[model samples]
Target chain A: MKTSTLRPLGRRAGDLPVAMVFLLPAAVGFAVFYLWPTLRTMYLSFTEYSLLAPPEWIGVENYQKVFGDRLFWNSLQVTVEYVVINIGIQTVVALGMAVLMHRLTRSGLIRGVLLLPYLVANVVVALIWYTMLDAQLGIVNQALEWIGVDPVAFFGETSTAIPTIALVNVWRHVGYTALLIFAGLQAIPKTFYEAAQTDGASEIRMFWRITLPLLRPALALVLVLTIIGSFQIFDTVAVTTKGGPVNATRVIYYYIYEQAFQRFNFGYAAAVCVALFAILATLALMQLKLLRAGETDLD
Target chain B: MRRTTRLTAVATILSLALAGCGGGDDPAESGGGTAAAPTEISYWLWDSNQLPAYQACADAFHAANPAVTVKISQFGWADYWTGLTTNLVSGTAPDVFTNHLNYYPEFAGKQQIQPLDDFIAADGTRTDVYAPGLADLWVSADGKRYGLPKDFDTIAVFYNKKMLADAGVTEEQMKTLTWNPTDGGTYEDVIARLTVDENGKRGDEEGFDKSKVEVYGLGLDENNGAGVGQQMWSMYALSTGWQFTDKNPWGTSFKYDDPRFQETVAWWRGLIEKGYMPSLAIARSGTSVNDGFGAGRYALSTNGSWMINTYYGYDGVEVGTAPTPIGPSGKRATIYNGLADSIYAGSEHKDQAWQWVKYLASADCQKTVGDKAVVFPAIPEALTVAEQKFAAKGVDISAFTVQIHENTTSLYPITDHASDVSAVMSPAMDAVLSFEAEPSSLTKANEEVNALFQ
Candidate 1:
């Protein structure tokens, strides 16, 4: 009876015009802004476009060159390194904060304070951290000196640059990610924990068996958003390292930026962008499937 | 079937609506529409420091020519190029904009800039009015003039007067230091004596702590400087009689691997090894070298003449200038770079823009700019006036001016694929400076840079 009453509205001819009216504005926006530019980028990937002249179609020449480009591969590897460090720490810390928030105060003030760093602009955060991590004059180095520990060249050494950038970004994003998971925690019933307590199950066991399985949908969403966001890390790198101390922080997006803006190699840049798009799309889909984003333990 | 037809109609309507709203291009406003039509042309420059002088020129220009006016816009250094390039492609760039030697080659090759030969011929403008080689620097490989040189700069050593005195070094000694690639010569001696450790021991003294430096003798503004190293190493390498390319303006071959250049780089890096200069990591840790100099953390800094006001602006600091150290070639050198004005090819008011560019290159506008003492004007007479202005301010700027007088200036490397060259050389140079790779690695990087030309 429920399935009959909840029949898909698209199947009825009478409701079709109403649905079209609602979707028209959004469809127009999508076509003009998103879809058109994407199509153009895809087409430009196979052509030679320098913005000064009309695009000349070269038939996969750019893609062929990308295969041999050492810088492109370096950028990809550096970007992956940043992603692993950023996501690995950010997820676990965010999950822990979410649980703490759910079990404890649930205070809006604490939540607001947690979201403060995320509210600040990425460039601002990067610059502030950059100053605070200066090898000689930064406060962080000064503190380390006070404790008899040697100062680390946070963004200066090639070995430490990518990890430093990733950690700074993790600091900025963890708060927002925590809030997202906190909202997910609120949707789970308190009665489940109470019932588990009555069943003589430990709190940790209840969290593992009940909390995590139900939180899959939210976790999947956060992973997809943060992962996609992480892959597009350009502003922080651009502001701080500028992909230097020797291309150590030259992530893929920054490499694409250098090619397109610095070298004016638009076609090659487009090819790289297309490759990045494919990678991110594949990652997003894999996460959704592995986590069963739509299925709920409650059902 | 009916539902599908309705959906297709909705999609078509949305597509048409998007198409209708997308036409944002402006119609070309006709220039010289009517006699005395009051055509206002737009001009853009990157340096905010020079805005007041340029604005003064604009006011004078408007008074002289009632029918035309110039509106000036200033953007920060990096944003200026990004904005200019985007606007140039979109046909919305200013009528005229400041041009750099590094970028004008690409701009000229792409035909985004207008050739000024015909305009110069029609106006009978004197091309020889600017400093020697300055006018020629803006000519493209096709032998077309793209810009008119407006101002010039040369690098010099700016040092803290109190630090030099406290180190028992006289100003005369500072002015006449000599150097060699082998052991760094007296130049290294002065730097080492100037550097102080945490316990207040000088770098040249026994028991000096290289790890815990209180003050660096030399302040570095950038790491490897993307292979240009204008203020940092250019003076040293050029003093050794080394050039960046096979020839000036449009040289296809680079000489980054040349032993003379490599040895100069090695000596410069050796300062860091000996605790006289900041390490590559500390130098590039987001703090301006000038800040360190201002805070007494740096005793000496090499900078271009354009920063004279900036160094002087630091409170409670008595700054003094010195020519770069004489090298094995028995001569001191500074890199001579200049900025110019270029007209966009798509400008509707090309004639008016040419008038402005001509005026800017003329002694009239340059004299006004010179009197402000902001920059060394391209015109010889105006440059003299600028020197007098500096003299009136009690600042001895002869160290910079002497380069031109002695003909010891090397032109800033002007070549196509400059950005590509920098991209390859920057990391390679960084590796060498950071002690991760040897200086010989620059040879591979130079090959990569040359490969781009092919």
Candidate 2:
């Protein structure tokens, strides 16, 4: 028995080499690409570099400029407003669709129809919305005229532009979010619902107590993803307004792009990037804590 | 504990894999191998339609010089600037590229563009071969010439002949029309009368609703940059004895707060207020004002001669070109915007790049390109060929050529922060046009912009 145990231990030790061989390429890739760049960006943020000259050590100057910039503050406000509004609306709309689709017998057709918008590229969505929202010749305004409502410049006005963009963002992603929630709904066993029904619980109570409680994990995942996606919003704003009508819709990423590419101010842009990463990391950690709290309460 | 360790290892590997996929190959090291092989020169340009003509010119140069090879690349105008600037900063810019006068200063200040003085001296090419006061415009403040003159453009009035006929107006009537700050000459009155409603009512008629009008006599888009909008307004402002700067070339302060400037803005704005022009909302929708004119949605639209080819291609539209309407300052003025071919200072093959640039500025290449009516070549001798080409195309473009000869002014001096200044000016001007602010408020905008320049 001792000889057999020793031989099995030797074989287990040999398996470690194979496992490392499988992981070596990926490990090397991550070290060279993501980790190195993140560290490099962090170092660069403390310097003054314009890509033309060698970087000069100017600790905290770049960071100070970022904080002092009114544009940066405006962009951050816009980003947060976009994230909160987008996440709230998208989550509710997605959940409603998922729940509705879950109860349907013909779920395949409904799910396929819902997945269509998610498959369309963001630029295409922007173009479609631009055409539809055009003030004079657009179908939306034309239809509004028929109803005796004055033509509204959906993108031209500062007040309506950001929300309109947010609405479009929510419209594009709702279907995908709903699909994720639908899968979570399916994974929850039917036996729980049956038991709840036998307890003579109302439909509303069953939904609140049974369905929502089980969906906590999926909800947490979707919420985190939506927030992250909303934070990085660039393409739609670029294609639609170009952050115009007096910079009403300028978001953080576009601001970063304008600095780095337009002004060729790489060091300042890198500082902004670092700050963005820190903010994202903090939000992610908070999400993890909230998720853990939810899990403990559920238990 | 064993499961947690395995998960950590997996996550670490995944993150490492992501990290490895980041930063591109250094361009400097990649192109070194081919650098010595046959002196391959790269040419960067933006216009797709003009690429064929450029390619033909490149072929001519190659035939003349068998040792050197030219490679041409095309990008959209915006991408061209972004890519050129990015590469310039990275020290891997193209050997030669088209440079706009407006953007030349920014690159020149950064030492991104090479001074072509030595090349011009070596070739013994006379600067007088080009238009007067044109060739010297590209020289930096340090007295270093940076680029070769390629083409020149001036703004003019493009009108629909059929629309004029429908309104009982003749081409002769348009030729005599003049303008002032307070009164927009006979042109404004004609525009007011020609602008029609669904019930065949004009802007000047009683019971004619400005909001409900079906057609506009004039089309103007406020969304355009100074390259277009400011050029149009300058015609009025200059005629009203307003100067964009204290001097024609390089004065420091803008004269927008001047009474003449205010009158010019008010006159342009009154077109919208009187319903002679489309509302700011409608004019901005769909295509630009040029497109609106092509679609026959407006009787007249103001544009530069560079877009003549674009306008001529439209069906059922009888196009006529005229000089800008005379303003109260007793002058019909046009802003002359030109383009040039500049050599990259950082280029390894400076000799070959200069050779190509000199060839472009030569009369042979200019005649070949300009004779096709593609553009008005900067070489003065090529003007005859260009005019003939336009006449061959069944339109006399001489109106613009004549306007430039008599009333041309160089675009505002190449400020170091020119793009930034324009960035501020464009939106501020838009705000004024949108009726959200007054023209005088531009002083505040100018102050903010001047602060940025400082």
Candidate 3:
């Protein structure tokens, strides 16, 4: 009876062009900004476009050059290292914060204060960290001096530079990630905790048995988003180190930036962008499979 | 869910269409206009300090040629490169922009800049009217002039008078200091003795805890920016008889790998190792080397001549200037770098752009701009007026004039991939200064950088 009544309403609504009105702005934006440039970049990846001259078809030569270049490989390694280490640290730290926040009854003020770092722009965050970590007059070094420790070269030493940048990245995102996980934790039913406690489970046992299982969906979402965000890490490196201290901080995006703008090798840069996309796509697929396995484990 | 998906698709299409239409109307597209309208030429420069002088030149030019309009825009040095590169790639570059000799070759090689041979020929302006070797700075091997000489700057040693007096050294005594590679001439001896603390501890004094020093004798950062790295290295290396490149314009063989080059790096490093100079980590903490000197933390700093006005303004700090200390080669040299006005090859108002360039080169514009005493004119004849103007301000800029005559060399020509080489070498240079790596490792660093050239 309900279906019969709703069928004509749906048909009439479909005929009213409501969806077009709703989707028009986004469609225009995507087609004009994202879709066209993405398609153009894809096409140019296979050609020789030097900005001054018209593009010429060069097949897979740009891709070949990208693969052969040592700097490209180094950039890839740096990007992967940055993504894996940063995402790992961010997840552990954020999840720990989430767990702590979950236990606290006073949430609003603490959560708001904790999320302040996330609210700051990346450039501002980089600048703040840069000033704090400056070896000479920075407060960090001054503190070290007070403690009778010799000042260590943070950005000046290549060994410590990448890790310092990664740590800053983790610090910037941990608050936001923790907030997301905390929201996920909030959404879990209190009855499930009661049930676990009633069944002779301790607080630790309840978390492992009931809470974590139910939080799989949220975990999967955060994991995917964090990985994608980590892969696009350019702003921090650019503002903080400029991929320096002997190229220790140079990520794939910075490399692409150098090739296209600094070196005027647009075709090669496009090829690099395509390679990055492929890497991200593969990682996303693997994440999906892992999430599926996680779901099955919950069942 | 179905309705949301359809709505999103429609919105995406609409947005794409709008963006596409907007993209077509770029500055480069409007660059080509009919001869009927008054021609508008865009000018790009980075320094806000010189904007007034440039604008004054523009106003003087427009007074005579009322049909031309000059649009001037400013960018920070870093943003200037990023914007220029992006605009060049997108075919929307400004009509006329400032060019540096070190970064100009890449644009000239790519033909992104229009050669001004015909324009120079038609205008009948003699390049010799400019400073000696100024015209060659912007000319490629093919004899194509890519820019018009704007002004030249050379490095000078700026010293604090109070610090020198505290060490019982007079200005007359400083003039007698000579230099050689091994001992750094009289300049090094004086600097080592003059650089002291409350306890009478000098930089070369044994049992001096470098980490505990309250004041440094000299301060210089080792990062790869225009100031300390490029400018100081050019002065030091050139003084040591090092060439940025071999005879071939595109060659990289003559770079930092040479033993003499290593000696120069080592000597500079010794300043820190011996506690004569502040540690790189501390020196770089300030916004600039000049800032350290201005704050009274360092007795001496080396920088370009244009910063005299900056030093004069600092209270309680009387400043004096001299040429860089001579190297082992018994020769003192300063890097002579000049800026130029370049027209984008893609501009539509090419004819009008040449007129603006011509007017900037005229004696009247140079005189008016030089009278402001901000920048010395590229025109040699207009320099006397600039000298008088600066003298009236109680600043002795005669060091620049004397240095130009006594010890000046044109900066190395722009290399096609100079920025790339810089990107590669900067970190290595930083490593050496930070004491994390041996100065000799610069050889390996050079090889690694040269590999990028191929």
Candidate 4:
């Protein structure tokens, strides 16, 4: 290994100006579209406003109310349940597929088939899941009946609605996650596995000791993403159950939408959004620290 | 990558910091200020079902008022409200738009809609010329008319004639069917007899298989009509003297706690326990109510006159219409609701917009709209024309008009916080339908609804 140093790209005066000129259009577009809306939402959280009137500042009253509101608490509980279930299923399926694909096939067709669902739009996936899980009309329950099993109320009962929704989410996201992990697996040095084999290490033991330790960065990434995606879930619940069978599947983001858009409670919805932000931000920080790659000194 | 991200974040902050200073409320006098004799006005409506008829109306209006041009835009139901709210905030609202009673009160309160009393006086318009109680619905508590009578809707029972024949029920009995809150009167008997089991037994039989019902007697759909159940339980409750509120157009509180209302809900929900109605879970989603009805699963359905075309569109089915049954109060009741065209308060071409709305409410346009035989127009003469047109289509729409002519309609609830009230009640209503809560628990829901007004 040779000792190396990194150089800054923007050090030269002429280079900085040229680079900025090239980047201005995209940066300006992002600022106008994304940054402004985000700041506006943050500012609105401290105010009580309807679409018809100007915002009136109440200074954290909306936040206090949200913490105390029954619906807010219910939706938060629902979101936590969904996140746990979805992440659990997605991680397992992703890791399993990654390990299996790493050991077995390199077929382009198989890889393409695995990547198809991740590329399908959320609306199409939700529509397919809803149609397949429908209580009376679904093919899933029909197949169950053909196997001499009782029909299941997948989207109807409270005990099953959230899990059923989580499963659909997993089905859509697992392929992408597995592909990401598979990429990480490919990047791992082949020498480590060979060294483990020289030591008479079993495949399972080598995977546990060598593969898992080095896969931390990718796993952390998948975990953080799974958390964010789980919290942001809305369309499936909206189209499938509509938070129904007595609000069994009313996730936090869906609740925020109903309050802000449907009920026009912009301030309270913004408060809920802020709470969600704090959670996601803290999780991201924790994951970053835990998953930072170890560095070896150059000789 | 880190340096680039930092640069982008800094640029974003700078842009927002600059943009923040210029952001202000949308000013009202942006468009249509000084009309050079003739100006084009924008009109928006939610119903694509009525778009063509209104497009024709716009054409004729351009003919009558050659100086003025009207442009129409149609949006889906959900998108329409979202777009309208956004436009109202941005001061880009259409010069004229169709308004619902459910949303108009909030608009009127916020002064987003213009009061039309001055125009009404200038044009010498007679609100009485339209259907009774329709023009009154547009009058606010401040005694200003904000809308003109455009169209009215009433609920009636649509039945499958073949199903009735198989069940040995006659059309005459259906026409004169009466109901009572206690045990449901003769209506319950008819519904039970119409209900059939997989074992080929009627609901009235001793060994009827309630668990294996093949065909339900009633169609309980998810279309709650803003939770008041215009198509389902409105007739049941209204005929039992259970008004949604003490007064409308600005009622202070709801009366969901009323024992009469509770009894009506309980009786309606009992149909599910008897397997005469589909379970709430099954009815609330998955399939459209009309589709379920057409599939021979529902022998009868409480449907609005607006959906007559939707039902008749189903092939190989003999559709029949009958008036709602009479109740214990010695009167049959229907929820009388109407839609209207209202001019936006911020519109600069108020005069031109008024001219368009005036013509829309006049006999000329209303008659033409009625001749299309799509919906029941609000004007009496237009309704007459519509009745003849519907006869030409071989469907008797009189089942809907009878409620209006007999004056058996109680107005649907109209209040300032109608949206909030609906939010508080819908979940509770769902709970009640799902048997998660008792009907009497609506009193607690009433308290929550009343608290919003407080």
How many angstroms is residue A173 displaced in model 1 relative to the true structure, after the best TM-score fit? Answer: 1.5
Ranking by TM-score: 1, 4, 2, 3
**Candidate 4 C-alpha lDDT tens digits along A1-299:** 23223445445655877899999999999999989888988999999988788999999999899888998889889989998999898998899899889878888788889889988766567656665554444567668878977556677666788998899889998988899889878877888889989999998998898878788777777788777878898977876677776778888998898888778899889989988888889987887787763431111
- For model 1, how does the per-residue alpha-carbon lDDT over B38-80 read when each residue is reduced to its tens digit? 8888888877789999999998988988888998877666567
DockQ of each: 0.32, 0.20, 0.31, 0.22
Best by lDDT: 1
Stronger candidate by lDDT (1 vs 3)? 1
Tens digits of per-residue lDDT, candidate 4, B175-213, equal: 899998889888999899999998999999999988777
Which stretches of candidate 1 lie above 4 Å from their native place?
A1-11, B1-36
Using TM-score as the measure, the top candidate is: 1
Give the distance in Å from residue B362's predicted Cα in candidate 2 to where it truly belongs: 1.8
TM-scores of the candidates in the order shown: 0.93, 0.88, 0.86, 0.90
Native RMSD of candidate 1 (Å): 9.4
Best by DockQ: 1
Cα lDDT of candidate 1 equals 0.86
Clashes found in each candidate (C-alpha, N, C closer than 3 A): 0, 8, 26, 0
Model 2 gets an lDDT of 0.75
Cα lDDT of model 3 by residue, B243-305, tens digit: 766653456454778887777778777878777787665554322456556656678777776
lDDT of 2 by residue, B171-266 (tens): 888877888777787878878877887688887788888877667888876354542254457667766766666553444565556777776787
User: Where is model 2 chain B poorest over a 10-residue stretch in terms of lDDT?
Assistant: B19-28
